[model samples]
Target: MTRVIDSAGSAYFGEAEGLLRAMRLEEALESYALAERSGHDPDACAGGRWMCHMLLGRYERAWEESDAIAARCKPDRHRFWDGKPFEGRRVIVRCLHGLGDTIQFIRYAPLVRERAKTLIVEAQPALKRLIEESRVADAVITWGEREPEWDQQIEIVELPRIFRTTLETIPAKIPYLDLPAAAPIAAYDGATDLKVGIVWASSSYNPARSIPLKQMARIFEAPGTAFFSLQAGAERSELALWRDRIVDAHTDERCVVPAAATLKKLDLIVTADTMMAHLAGAMGRPVWTLLPFHCDWRWMKRGEDSPWYPTMRLFRQPRAGDWESVVDRLQAAIEETIKGRRLVPPGDPGAQAT
Candidate 1:
C-alpha cells in the first residue's frame, strides 16, 4: 500500500515554521490556519497554533490547543497528570524551558500540590533553593541530578493549561516566592531618594527584548531618582562606564533570591522583559516593564497593566523597532512621578502612550 501526502498542507506548514522562526507570529498563525484547512494533520500544526494563540493573548483558545500540542510535542514517558482527580498519587513537575519561564510559572506549584499527595519539583539548578524555600512543593530537585521516584510527571508550563486558566482567572497572587531569612540586605545610600532599579539588557539570544545601555543614558540622568543596576551576566560590565550614574546592585548570578531581596527595597523597578521583570512582578513590587512592539503574550495585546501581575506597569514601543519613543515616555512618566504628579492608572487611555 502507498500513502498520500497533502502537498499544499506541507507547504503552508513549512511557511508557518519559517514565519514563526522569524518572530512574525501573526503571519505564522495565518499560515498555520491555512495549513490546517489544507488537510494538514492537526497534530503537526497544534504547537504552532498554540504559540500564536499564546502570543496573541487568546488564553482560552490557547488552553484548548494545549492538549494536542502536548501530545504531539511532549509524549509522556511516565504517567502524566492532565488535571485529573488523583488521590494519593506522587507527581513530579519538570522545568523544561528558560530560567525566566521557570520563575514565572513556579507559582503554580502549590496549586499542583493540592491535587497530589506528594509533589516533587525538578527545576534548573539556579532555582532549586528559591523553589524549595517557597514551599510550593514537598521535595525540590535540580535538573541533571538523580531522579526521584514519582508516579506522574508534567512540565511546569503545562500547569496553566491543566488548570484551564483564562486571562481573568490567572493566579495573580503576589509574593509567591519569598526571600530567605538569611539573605543579605541590599546596601544603598538612597534612603530619601526615589530608588529606581533598572535593567538594560536581557539574554543575548533575544536581542529585541534589550535596550542599548547608551540609549538609556538620559534615563540614568534623571534627577531626584537613584538608579540601581539589577543587571547580571556580561551586561553588568556596561555599568563600569556609568559607575557614577548607577549603583551596582549585582549580587551572585547563580541565585535570584538575593536579587529579589534587593528589588524589595527599591521604590520602583524599570527594566526590559527579563527575569528581573518577572521577579519584581512576582514579589508584588511596582515594576515598569519596557516592551518592544512584538513582546511576549503574557503582557497581552494592548494593556498597561498585566493580568499576571497587578502591580506591573507596561511601557510599549509606539511602533516596531522604535525604542526611542518608549524611552521618551518612560522618562516623562518617571519625572512626573518624581514631581508627585497624579499619574493615570493602568488600563486608562492616558496611560497607554505615556
Candidate 2:
C-alpha cells in the first residue's frame, strides 16, 4: 500500500501506520499512544498497538488488548474461544480467516483433538480435502454442509491464545499436514538434482504480500536448477513471458491440493507470503518465504527463521517497496547453496549428506 496518508486521516494515526509498515515497533507503539491521545479512533489505536506487541514477540501484551477488545466486541463477538474448559466435550474448531491462516494454525488441531471427546473442523471448502487427508481432525466439514453434534466451539486462530502460546512455546512440529496418499504431479520432470517451485503473487487486496514476477528473473539465471511455476491466479499467466526459463507446473485441478502434491516433488519452494508458503512449511519441505518489510504478526519483523515452521526460512525486505534487494539476497543464497552441494561419487558411503 501507499505510505502517503490520505487527506482525511488524523496525522498521529497516519504516522503510526507508516511506522508500523516499516516494522518500527517501538516507534509505532509510541505513535499509537499519541493517536489515542489526539482523539483518533481509540480502538484503532489499540489495534495498532496490539499488532506492534504481537510482532515484538510479546503475546501477553497483545492479548491484553485482545481481552479489552473482546469485552467491547461482546454479543457482536469476534473472539470465539470463551475461555472455558471443554475436556470430553465434542468441540468444533472453526476456521474463520483466510486460507493461509487456517493452514498455519491447523497444526494445533491434533492438540485440541486429544483433549476433546471428538473434534470436527469447519474449514473452507478449498482446504477440506487436504485437511481431511492429513487426518488432523476426526472429521472436516464446511459451512452450510451439515451439522454434527458439537458442544464447544472455538475459532482456529484462538487456539494459540487458548494454549497460551509464547515464542518459546509455539508448537514447532513439521509434516503436521500430511496427505501421504497424494500423487505426485503427473507432469513433474523428476529432477533428482534440484527442482525449485516459485509463487510470486498473492491476493491483490494486499499487494505488499506479492512480488512482481519480473523481480524473480534473476533466479532462472542459475544453471543446473529447474524452475517451475506453482503460482496461481492472474499471476500464472505472467509465466508465458518466461516460458523458456520456467515451467508452468500448475494443473487444471481446482482446489489447493495440487500445490501440496507439487510441493512434495520439488527440492525447494520460493514463494511470497502466500498460502503456498504455509503449506510448504506444514508439509516439512524446504521453503524460503519472501515477506514485505511490515508483514503479519506471525512472521515477527526480525528473523530468517520462523518459530512456527521448522523447515521454512524467511527473507524480508530491508525497506518498504524494495523487492530488488530481497531478490538479490535470495539469488545469492541459492547460488551459495548450489555450490555447497558436493557430489557423493556413487557408493562412497562416507559422503552421505547427513
Candidate 3:
C-alpha cells in the first residue's frame, strides 16, 4: 500500500504508519502526537502510539495511552471497555477489526465468560461459523444479523487493554478455537511426505505484510515435504506456475470452516502475518509465521517464539524487505522438521506441544 493518504491528519499519520513499518517506534510516536495536534483523529493517532509503545515492549505506556484514548472517546465512538470490572453484567463483545485480529484475541472469551453473566459475540459473517464452534460465547451474531439483547458491549481488540495485559499476563492458551464438523481435506498426492500448508500474501491494504511467492522457492526444496496452498484470493493466481508442485487446497473463499478442517489434516502451517497463522495457532497446530521488519506490534519487540501462542514460531526479516534470509532460515527449519519426523509423527498431539 502507498504511503500517500488523503484525509485529515493523513500527512503526519501516514508518515507515522510508514515509520512504524520501518521499525522506527520512537519517531512514529512523535509523528502520531504531531498528527493529533494537527487536527487528525486523536483516538486514531493514539491507537498508533499505543502500537508503537507495545512494539517497544513498553506495555505500561501502551496501557496508559489506551486509558487516555478510552477517556476521550465515547461509547458511541465504538471503542469502549474501560478498566472497570464486569463480573455479573451482560456483555457483548463485537469484532470490529480484521479476521486475524478476531482470531488472535478471541482467546480472551473464556475469561470474559467467567466474569460476565452472559456474553454475546457480534462477529464478522466470515468468522461467525468458526467462532460458534469455539463454544466460548453465549450467543454469536453477524454484522447485519439480529440479536436477542446485550446489556453492555466491548470491542474485541479492547479485551487486552481492559484486562491490563502485559507480556507475562498474556493468555497464551492454545486450541481456543474449534473446527466445525466438516469433511476432511482431499487426500494429498505426497502422502508419505510432511504435509505443510503455506500462505504468502496478506490483504493489499498492507502489502508490506506479504512476501513475494517467487521468494519462497527455497522451502519447496525441502525433502519429504508436501506443500499445500492455504492461500486465498487473487494471490492464488500467483500459484499457477507452481500448481504442479504445490497442491491447491482452496475451495470456497468465503467459507473458512472447510479450511479449518483442512488444517487439521496438515502437519504444519507456514504463513505471513495473516488470519491463517492466527487460525493455526489458535487451533493448537504447529505454525511458523513470517513477519516483515516493520511488522505489527502483536509480534512484540523481538523473539523467535510468541508468548500468545506457544505452538507458533516467528521468522522475522533481519532488516526491512530482506525475505531471502528469512526463506533460508525457513528452508533449514523445514529440513530439521523432516529429519525429526520419526520423533513426532504427523498429526501427533505432541507436535503442537512444542
Candidate 4:
C-alpha cells in the first residue's frame, strides 16, 4: 500500500500532513521536495519542511530552508525581520520553546554573539530572566508582553549546527548559568546515600515520548540509591505512592532552583526529554535520558550518547511506549552504580549495550 497519494495534489498534501503528524521528518521532507519539484509553490511547503528539519536535528538544512523562506518573505514589520541591518555581520536567533531549550542552546550564544550583535527573542518571561542572568546574549528580548517588530530573524534551534556542532563541539563548562542569590538553596545534605534525582514526565503534549510515571517507579527499586523527585506540578501526586522512600523536593522552589544547585548536588539525574535533562546536561552533570523509540534525531538512530550535550547518555525505548526494556536497562545500570561500578561511561560500547 502506498503511503502517499498522487490524486489532485491530495496525495501531496495528504502525505506531507501525515508525515508531519507522525513526526516522520525525513519522509515529510521528501514529500515537500516532491511537491516543490511538481510545480507546487515552494513557500507553501517551506514552513512544514523547516519544522520537520528542526525536529530531526537537521539544523543546517532547517536554516537553509528558513533562509529561503526569509528571502522570499516580503520585508514586513514583523519581528522576524528585525535583524536585517546586522544580517551578514551577525546572527539573529529567533527563540523557540521553554526556558530549558533557551538555556541548552544558549551555549552557542557567545559564539554567535562573538560574530554578530546577537538578539534573542524568547516566548516566556522566565526565559528572558534566565538569559539575562546568564548574560548569554547582548539583548534578551521577550515574545511575551511585547512582540518587537524585527527586520530579520533566525530560529534559535538552528544555532548548534550552523556553528558546525558535533559531540566534541559541546561547551561542557558548568556554572554557565548565572542564577542570582535572591533565593538561596543549600546543597542536598539530607541523603547519606548516593543521591539520584529523577523527573518522571515532560510536558503532556508529547506523552508518547515521555516515560510514564509507573515506569519510573522501578528506579526507586535500585538498592541504596536515594531517589529524589525534582519534578514540578504533578510530581507530588504521581510519586506519592512511593511514600517516604522518595524525596519530595517539589514542596518548595528550592528543589529545582533555576541556578541548578539541587540538580548539581546529585550524583546522577535520570529524566525524560525535558528541560531538566537539558539543564543537567548543560551543567556537565551526569544525566541518563529516557527517550521514546522514535526519539528526536539529535539523539541519533540507536545511539548511546548525544552530540547536543557531552555528558548526556540516552536510554531509548526498544519499542514506542514500551518502557519495560528501557527501564530494565536503567535498573541494571543503577544497580551497577550501587555496586560501586562506574555504570559505563557515555559513548562506551557497554553503555550503549541493551
Best candidate per lDDT, number? Answer: 3
- Candidates by lDDT, descending order: 3, 2, 1, 4
Per-candidate TM-scores read 0.85, 0.90, 0.85, 0.74
Looking at model 2, which ten-residue stretch has the lowest summed lDDT? 1-10
Of 1 and 3, the candidate ahead on TM-score is 3
Q: What is the Å distance of residue 176 in model 2 from its true position?
A: 0.5
lDDT of 4 by residue, 1-354 (tens): 122323434457568867876667778888888776655666768877866765666666766776687678645343343433454454456666556666677777777666554455453555566557667765666664554444456666556645655455566565566555434345366555678888877877777666667776766776567878877766458876886678766534432344376775678999888878887887678899988876665565457887667778999777656789988899888887766644556457675321
Scored by lDDT, model 3 comes in at 0.85
- In candidate 3, what are the lDDT values of residues 1-354, reduced to their tens digit? 223332546789999989887778889999998888777888889889989999877888999987887677555555666555778888989999899899999999989999999999988888898889889999999998887676778999889878889888889877899765556445853377899999999999889899999999867877677899988889999998887689899866586788888888889999999999998999999999999987888898689998888999999999988999999999999988887866666577765322
| lDDT of candidate 2 over 176-262, digit per residue (tens) | 887776665655645655689999998987999999898889889896678989888877889888999898988544577877888
lDDT of 4 at 158: 56
Off by over 4 Å in 4: 1-8, 16-29, 38-41, 44-58, 74-96, 116-123, 127-133, 137-155, 158-175, 178-187, 251-259, 341-354
- Ranking, TM-score, top scorer first: 2, 3, 1, 4
The candidate scoring highest on TM-score is 2
Off by over 4 Å in 3: 1-19, 26-48, 73-76, 82-84, 180-182, 186-190, 342-354
Give the poorly placed runs of model 1, Cα more than 4 Å off. Answer: 1-7, 10-30, 39-41, 70-84, 144-148, 180-186, 341-354
Against the true structure, candidate 4 reaches a TM-score of 0.74
With candidate 3 superimposed using the best TM-score fit, by how many Å does residue 213's alpha carbon deviate from the native?
1.1
> Considering summed lDDT, which 10 consecutive residues are worst modelled in model 1?
182-191
lDDT per model vs. reference: 0.81, 0.85, 0.85, 0.67
Could you tell me the TM-score of candidate 2? 0.90
